[model samples]
Target: MDTSAPVRILTVCTGNICRSPVAERLLQAGLDQAVPGGFEVASAGTRAMVGEPMQPISADIVRTFGGSPDHFAARQLTPNILRGVDLVLTMTSGHRGEVLQLDASLLKRTFTIREFARMLDVLDQRAADGVAEAGAAVVPSTADAHDGASPLAANAAYWRGLPARAAGVRHLSLPADSSENDIVDPYRRDPGVYRQMEDQLAPAIVSILRHARLNAPSAEAAAGPGS
Candidate 1:
């Protein structure tokens, strides 16, 4: 519930070698730059991609786009993975269901990546409402309230500062008229196809980051402590 306790976010795909890793790195980069220490990002595959490296072409594409290739590795999805993850961004609707099956409580935290981005839209609106009600002149803290303090209270305080309305759950629906519950898996496909999927994913990733920031209560809390 506390958005600030290093938001544990996981990005998932069929193979960790391509899309999931790419999304993980991009989201990490964005979070590091925009909201340092506020998020912890990781990636995993639905299928066992254990001990594999990123595909050569995937590496090439990541480098071509200026993404960090050093921090990626393949791992399979599991129920325990849902424990601490604040959010789970899967490649498709089926993946979302799979994650939920692993842990039904995740039904609240998991979503197809696009759906998560859409949820961000709602969170932003709620945060805006909080901002409006608190007025335009309040200045609040940007760092975690317990940066150097106790863990339990620090965590509770962060969650408490969040807009109670925005702190509730969110869900996703498959886009209409789309047979593909996911972006077609391009893991073993041609590099061009991977690139095409990349094109689709990149924008959605940015939107997710933007929404996270817009909805980020800590930033607003820093602006108005009691707000």
Candidate 2:
């Protein structure tokens, strides 16, 4: 892609009616709040319940997180959908594998939601350290930087840069165990299971939005005068 186009992020799950839609809404809401219009979030299922709405409990959880669950119909995953998406976040390692089976080249941009969250934590620390090392060099003068690049645009560029960064550090062990990286499917389970899914998804959404905000042009402008 076109960097000028909105960064598209896709969330994948088995049926699309539960985990993926919930994650999709939550991420969109969070990103909207953090950096309005910075990204677009959509969801699909490897084996989709096509045209179905999200599970009632899943919608409730989304509402609890202040996300709207309206008009959400399940979609089937396809290589075409994957082709345009900037990032793919899956509910489980199995889902990630399914996505990769569709398009093997997506390996770099595809990650389990928890895995990406953990990676974001690492990236944030590295960014902080980079700023410190360069003696507050994180914020470049907006005038000297790319013309007409808004903070959201700058953040979008940073978002695009993640795959390369991830590739460079692929050899390093992740901080969490691989087993802990998956968000278990809560379909037809009790309310508590749905809550568990919410617990897992919410923070990861926050982390991603937070990182995007940090790279936004507004953030750079806010930091400019003081330095």
Q: Could you say which candidate leads in TM-score?
A: 2
- Candidate 2's error at 67, in angstroms? 0.8
Candidate 2, 140-212: lDDT as tens digits:
4222335556665555665676655644544452745777788978998988888788888888888877776
Model 1 ranges with Cα > 4 A deviation = 1-4, 122-174, 179-181, 215-227
Stretches of candidate 2 exceeding 4 Å from the true structure: 131-145, 167-176, 219-227
Q: Clashing residue pairs, candidate 1?
A: 139-223, 140-222, 140-223, 141-222
lDDT of 1 at 185: 72
Clashing residue pairs in candidate 2 are: 151-216, 151-217
Ten residues in sequence with the least summed lDDT for candidate 2: 133-142
User: TM-score, each model?
Assistant: 0.72, 0.85
lDDT (Cα, 0-100) at 207 in candidate 1: 74
